[model samples]
Target: MAAQLVRAAKTESKGKPERLRFYYYTAGSGGAGPTILATSFLLLGEEVVAYNKGEKIKLKPYSGMLNIDFGKGIGKRDVYLLNLPEVRSAHDVLGIPTVSARFGTAPFFWNWGMSAMTNLLSPEFLKDRTKVQQLVQLFDPLVRAVDGIAGERVSMRVDLECTDGRHTLGLFSHRKLSISVGNATAAFALAILEGSTQPGVWFPEEPEGIAIEARELLLNRATEGTINFIMNKPPWMVETDPKELGLGIYVLQFRTQVVEITDLSGGFDLALKAADCSEVYSFEDIHENRKPPQ
Candidate 1:
């Protein structure tokens, strides 16, 4: 997918990529109701940006606070990726100026361990059951709330736009993507896709987040199947009223149409059906399965 986007940008766009963005929206259930916590960061030529309180805000490299709290307030907090290294060097190779990425659960990913340490350091931890639970959840909020935070419910999206505002390339996997090669299992979300380096076969959701170059190499390496080039258009939201609502009711209330432009390619006849993979979602239903054999 990365290789395809890079090819489109290089051939269709006139100048360098204007920006690069990455997003991870985890689905969850909480007190208010079922809550979906979405965390995203954008990479501009000179700075980083995040969406908070309905506006775009700038953030520093390692010091800025990118808010992940989405009002429902389950594990609401502002932490700078806990000084983690989501910022990668792939931009240099992608022709984008920078690749600054900060996820919504990053703080929790590293901070959960902090909770363990905090309890260990406190001599009274053995006697304080309430304190132990409180401190543990306080530092690692999602330990108990796992609906959307972990597993297949987590969805990811990537965008690459040209500096000229002429092209934008986007890829969205509405759930976790995992692949198995021999004995090793690779989950796309587990790896941050730091650099351009890979040499192997590409799975449907290619678990490795294997380098962009390796996927394109499938021409001679492994092209026994088909590739899908999804084009996002028409009514993106398909609203359905649950039977519990007495036949006519809308559960979701908000909608935003993503407007991006860029080059897109590939074929969409090969959709994988694996019970183990969390992400086997399709942006559109136009596939070979729906058509008569040629």
Candidate 2:
């Protein structure tokens, strides 16, 4: 079937303003695609491919996915991030609440699943003042309880007395070290931890567009690919106020190395000027050896 522009926005510039258009599509091979059944809610919701509540959609026909075009004027911060269920419901459903309500803090001190379920079943278990006080007292005495247990087994303890008490230490008194690592692996780890966050290594700057494609990929499990797009800036902005124009690179490292990039048609254009550019001479370029095919 043909692609549908499910959401579209067009804004013109007296000056520049961001505009975005979102589209979704599906395709199937050999035979016609599965039928989409529409559903309606009390208030009109965003259009969704209609499917019966309990109907199962086959894996093959639903493969063709969406393409998000965050128009030229969009900013990185302006992007709205949503999970699949939230995106499917068009943000009507609040799937998961914050950790503070379910657990006790922003970075939860307990297992998320257990704490979330506990709060889901009994709402006030973490929220109520009395319950929190009781938990604090119970956890307060856990230190002493652990100290009294004498055994040859391994033990771990959290002392909540530090000024910034969130710090944790792993102790392994009877541990043995036999893990093998070469020199290259050791140096790479050091470089990533020490070098990347420093100014000389990498620069952090504001990005140009709303990267909704990555968010969509996260939500819908889109296939592996590198997405690129161009943003056309006004002549005045490009020539006079380059920094104010705020053009920079934002690299999204793969969870796993992208074995291949499926499409590169949407790539953004960059106008590099010699005035602000630096040149470097490389002493050596690193190369990898590929294994021969069987």
Candidate 3:
């Protein structure tokens, strides 16, 4: 399914409301196959994640106001989608509702690989300097905020195996989002979104994270999956410096366990696997005072 930005989310007094619509360009039969995919978006202080499968993926809501037809021709069918909170629990800490993904289901025959294509075309991955400059101009405010306070740039990276059967992984960024800030923040990356029954491990008793006082993390089984964001090296380690060369540099390195994807009537499910893709972010702290070499 081909995806494009339909509209931008408006900010609310509390935070901001995120709304996105993608269009699907279909072809061939509209049935069979249970291909699963996900999309992520950042809104206010939260992230929204949406997942969908065959014949149930919607290309309308994602179409937004922007429309395009690459002569691939569109089809009429059904679509499917699922909405989930990207940042599970951020109310207590941010004093605002976090962002979440919205989903729907329909039937259609689209490129199917559109999701991966969109990620590839995303400004972060595009090699075209003009396209990159346009993106920076469009997201100047947000980009500046992330770079200024968060100390890094925002990016989305996807890895998929179209030929071989393997689970797909999306590494939005290597910086650990603040376990405290919620939503994907350029600042305070998620060093370790982990959990353990052991004391001093820093966690709450909720399925996700607990809410109270200064805010303790609950970290349930599902939330435990968040650990996939962390790397083996120290979270704050200055592994490399790209600023000296006068370029914005960020790298996301991750390692993953092989999780073969199988399709059944019940849907695509697999053994939870891990891949190491941790990252390092280098940016000049605008707030730091400069000291000449002595």
- Largest lDDT belongs to which candidate? 1
- Lowest lDDT sum, 10 consecutive residues, model 1, at 36-45
> Which tens-of-lDDT digit does each residue in 137-234 have in candidate 1?
45345534553344432323345555675434333322222211111222332232434334454443333445444544432222221121232211
TM-score, one value per model: 0.38, 0.18, 0.19
Instruction: Tell me how candidate 3 scores on lDDT.
Output: 0.24
- Give a tens-digit lDDT track for model 2, residues 102-161: 001011121232233332534334445455445445543432243233111111111111
Sum up the clashes in candidate 3.
Answer: 54
Instruction: Tell me how far the alpha carbon of residue 169 in candidate 2 is from the true structure, in angstroms, after superposition.
Output: 29
Kindly indicate the candidate among 2 and 3 with the higher lDDT. 3
Candidate 2 has its poorest 10 consecutive residues by lDDT at: 97-106
RMSD of 3: 23.5
Candidate 2 whole-model C-alpha lDDT, 0 to 1:
0.20
Instruction: For residue 133, give model 3's deviation from the true position in Å.
Output: 47
Candidate 3, residue 34: the lDDT equals 20
Candidate rank order under TM-score: 1, 3, 2
lDDT, residue 124, candidate 1: 48
TM-score-best of 1 and 2 = 1
Q: Give the Å shift of residue 57 in candidate 1.
A: 13
Model 3 CA deviation exceeding 4 Å by range: 1-60, 64-210, 213-217, 220-222, 225-227, 230-294
